[model samples]
Target chain A: MTDRISNKKNITLSIIAIIVMLAAIYVLDIVIKPTSSWSNLMTCLEKGTIYALVAVSMNLLNGFTGLFSLGQAGFMLIGAYAYAIFAIAPEDRATVYQYYEGGGLIHFSLPHMLQDMMGGADAFGGTIGYYLGIILLMIFAGLITAVIAFLIGIPVLRLKSDYLAIATLGFAEIIRSFFQWEGLGPVTNGSNVLRKFASYDSSIFPVLVAGICVAFIVLLINSSYGRAFKSIRDDEIAAEAMGVNLFKHKELSFVISSFFAGVGGALLAMFQNNINAAPFTSNMTYEILLIVVIGGIGSITGSIIGAYLFVCCSEWWLRGLDAGEFLGIEADFMSPGFRKVVFAVVIMCIVLFYSRGIMGTNEFSWSGLFNFFKTLPKRIAAVPGKIKAKFSNKKHKKHTENVKEAQ
Target chain B: MEFIAKWLPYILAGISVGGQFALIAIGYTMVYGILRLINFAHGDMFMIAGLVMVYMATVLPLWVSVILVLIITVVLGCTIERVAYRPLRSAPRMSIMISAIGVSYFLQNMALYITGGLTRTYPTIDWLQKNITIMGASTKMVTIITPVLTIVLVIALVFLIKRTKIGMAMRAVSRDFDTSALMGIDINRVIAVTFIIGSFLAAVGSILYFSNYTGIMPTSGSMPGLKAFVAAVFGGIGSIPGAVVGAFVIGICENIIKGLGLTTFSDAFTFVLLIVILMVKPTGLFGEKNIDKV
Candidate 1:
């Protein structure tokens, strides 16, 4: 009875902690904003929230489920394009604004339904309508991406890890190619979607939507289904023997993960107001993989932590490369590509030394937090002794092996 | 007749490219046969060999540079086996495969960092650049050379595998690693030999490929590597002859698709082919069927 009471208390405390954290984040968002910089701060927060959403979804499949997926960007591309098609104003589509027209295949017409549904040449409605349209478009984009993921996953998921990686990569390339197709240009805007969606502020929406999506994923991860996901990750054979229908669970997780990824992609589209095939390449997938790996695979908090760190590292930390006066470095001394060089090195170093990632599969728990503080001094004191013992054991083993060889 | 006249040259060109692919595909197939691990770094090795050839050409005569590059690449291949793979002999298949990918990424990045992501151009050899006319059709010297060299190499490899004691040891090791070790075969040496031979073939393929393509980049290996891997799978990943056959099929098919004036669909066509093939034959065309023990 006391144990049950304690469990109830624990749940209540966790709920309170979540509320506190959200409140703290909101306060920080406000505090960090300079009087003149309120809009930009909000924009950054929104963008971060969007990345957090995708990272969390990626974590569900790659982290918790142990699936090495490389098609997240592809799904994102799908979502972004879907959102663009559904939400773009009809007037914007028929505009005679040409970027560079010396072309062999210059112009195409939008389908009648797309034209009519977008209110037939007057789709840019009032502010409330536009916002509502954006929300509905994002959801529709998510569902569309989920369906694509389902189709791709059905045949491709039957393959093992490496094969699965290749298959998914192929799927991503196909999707990218599909978007680039001239035949689909009328709807996709075919390398020119940015100009069409220029009026909408994509930055703010990404953060808000991304944040909400991350919260939803967190809730899902803490559920019974999440436990089953972890069980499958720990040992697939054992999980199957335990009556976890492998394909069904994998398909469900993949679809769910991809659905959020599509939404995240929609948010990303809003940020840039441009959807091109180049940024949605394997490199993007690799970047996400790096985030998951650096954060700690199979941990929800880790994915969020990793995504924020990665974005900051890419945006702020690497911003130093451009600061020639501060570092006493000339413009020529710092190659524009130095960020990638550094990022690659960091990934290699992390993989070699801290393969388990920062959180090491452990989530943020109050007890864990208390334990960390309590054990800090003891761990520090014991480090040297542990190192000495490790060396001695290694030496003993080597000596014994030498003696056995000699005999 | 008109279609044949228009498409035959493209088909032939693809076959020549396929021959180059076959050379690379064998390496993938052989390594997978023995280890059950895809050597993702093999493509980078091909890139490195091309770079090595470009460097060697500056110091030596053309034939001498080719020979020297082959020898150096073989040594590099053996060294990679010793350093990266030997220690991980007991690790999980997935870990080793991931390690291979890491190595591939590391090599490609290192190349990019060193070269500043610039495309390296090989010194123009007049003979290689020259076009050869045969039966009212024109083809580059490299195109003809690629197929001839590929055939010679394949024949030599087949003979070596069928007739040599070392080849028997390789077969034994591939069949059963521990049992071969118990039978007094030096597993390490055999594995080293496998890598050396694989790298040698990759070096040869790289040289031929660069001669045809003219410009080589750090990422030049990835597409070819992936295609070769797909070919290896298509032919039955563990079967050498199968890999060669798969390469030709992919090369020819891709070229035909390109010939159809749908260049954008080339990659898609290859993947669709892979999916369709896998659905038909999961173990691949030449792969040995096995009963699932579990």
Candidate 2:
């Protein structure tokens, strides 16, 4: 009975914390205008939310399932393209697809179409319809990518380890080239940027979407299927021996992880307000993979923390390093690409020395936090005594050495 | 005659580029044979070789710059092995691969910072730049010289690997890493020698490659690097002759696709071929089959 009550209390506390975080984001979004120096935090929050989703999805496959697939960028490309292609305002099609002669295919806009059915954009009904349409559109994007992943998985999933990584990487490159092919110019815009798509006016859209997706992922990870996935990661043959359908579980994880990655891509496209297939290279996949590694591969919360830290550090904190005036210390060697160089070196150090990363396959818990805080004062109070003991021990060792020499 | 004349340039370019790729692929195959690593930074190393040659040629004589480039590249490759890869010898394979990716990222960023994102013009070697005619298809002398140079190097490499004590050590290490160590082979020394040979060949490949191109960018190495890796895999990774053959095939096919006006698919074609090969024969044409143990 006490355990049940404690569990209820924990749930309530978590809900409260989430509400508080959301409220804080809303307040910050209203207070800090885009032009302010502090706006970097907002940009970080937006990009970080998107990256968090992608990183966690990747963690699902690479960490939980032990499938080292490197096709996240390709899935993201499909998602971004699907979202952008379908969400473009019908009137803005000519302007966005200037090379395609009014986008020979995909003429309808999901939001605009839904808005029209609900008495146009000025009414409350239309406003609700627009958001609803966008929600459906994002899901549609994820579905499209999921379907493609299903097809790709059939042939590619049989390969082991590094071969799978390389094969998926190859598929990503193939998808990139296909998207850039001129014959598919009308639909994909032939390597040109797709823009003027429907996007969120407020940052809450991403935070909410990412929060829900992460919650679902967390729930999945706690389920029996997640345990099966973990078993496979630990030992595939052993997993098979224990009656876990290895291929089925692997495929399920791949599809679901890819589904979330696709949504993340759509969100990314929304955040950027434009999309291009060019930047969706193997490098992007590597960046996300690095994020997962930094976050402690098997921990979802770690991925979230790592994603935010990575985005904020690279996009905001490291900006000063690039501009040559970080912390009021200016140096001639600090140039445009110096920040990335420094960032890469730091990542190398992390990979080499701190391989367990920030969380080390552990999840965050409220009880753990409370216990840490409770012990903080006691730990701090013991610091000076420990230091004195160390110093006296060194002195005693020196005196003993002198006495021995005299003897 | 018209058909032959029309197709000659593409085939010639293919053979030349194939030779260049062959050099790079040999590096990849040899390293993978011993270490079971993809060595993602090998491509970046090739790019650095090009950049080093460009900068050195401006201040030093051409021959001196070439030699210096080779030495610098060897040093860089060995240093990377020592610093980035050696410490993680006991770690999982994935961790080492991630470290390699990290190294690649570092190298690319370093190049970007040094070049200030500018495309450097490749210094033209007079001998290489001279036009030569082969069967009514005129091309740079480098086109002809690349294959000859590549064959000579491969012969020497094969001879060394088949005859020398270090080569035997390498073969033993690749065959069984722990067992070779138990047999008194200096594992670190063998690995370092592999990097030396790989980097030296890559430097040579860079010289021949950049001689054909008018400019070199920070990203110039990635495409060729990937294609060469694909070649290595296609020829059955860890097999030298297989890598060479695979490089030639992919090079010819890619150029042929370009010749056919499907220019965009030229890069994609290599991957398509890779997937097909991987699906049809996971062990590749010359690769020994690996059995998973419980």
Residue B206 Cα positional deviation in candidate 1, in Å, after optimal superposition:
1.9
Q: Evaluate all candidate structures by whole-model CA lDDT and list the values in order.
A: 0.77, 0.92
lDDT of 2 by residue, B198-277 (tens): 99999999999999998998888877888899999999999898999999898888889999999999988998888899
Per-residue CA lDDT of candidate 1, range B1-294, in tens?
776678888887898889888989999988988887888789888998888888778888988988988998898888767766776788656456546666676667666755678888876777877998755568888888888888899899988887999999889999889999999999888888889889999999988788887788888887788789889889887888888989999999999989988777787777777777777887788988855554
Tell me how candidate 2 scores on lDDT. 0.92
Question: Can you tell me which runs of candidate 1 are displaced by over 4 Å?
Answer: A1-52, A94-128, A191-205, A234-238, A318-339, A398-407, B51-84
Which candidate achieves the best lDDT against the true structure?
2
Candidate 1 chain B minimal-lDDT segment of 10 residues? B92-101
> What is the C-alpha DockQ of each candidate?
0.40, 0.76
In order, what are the TM-scores of chain A for the candidates? 0.79, 0.93
Best by TM-score: 2
- Segments of candidate 2 deviating more than 4 angstroms: A1-5, A378-407
Candidate 1 Cα lDDT to native: 0.77
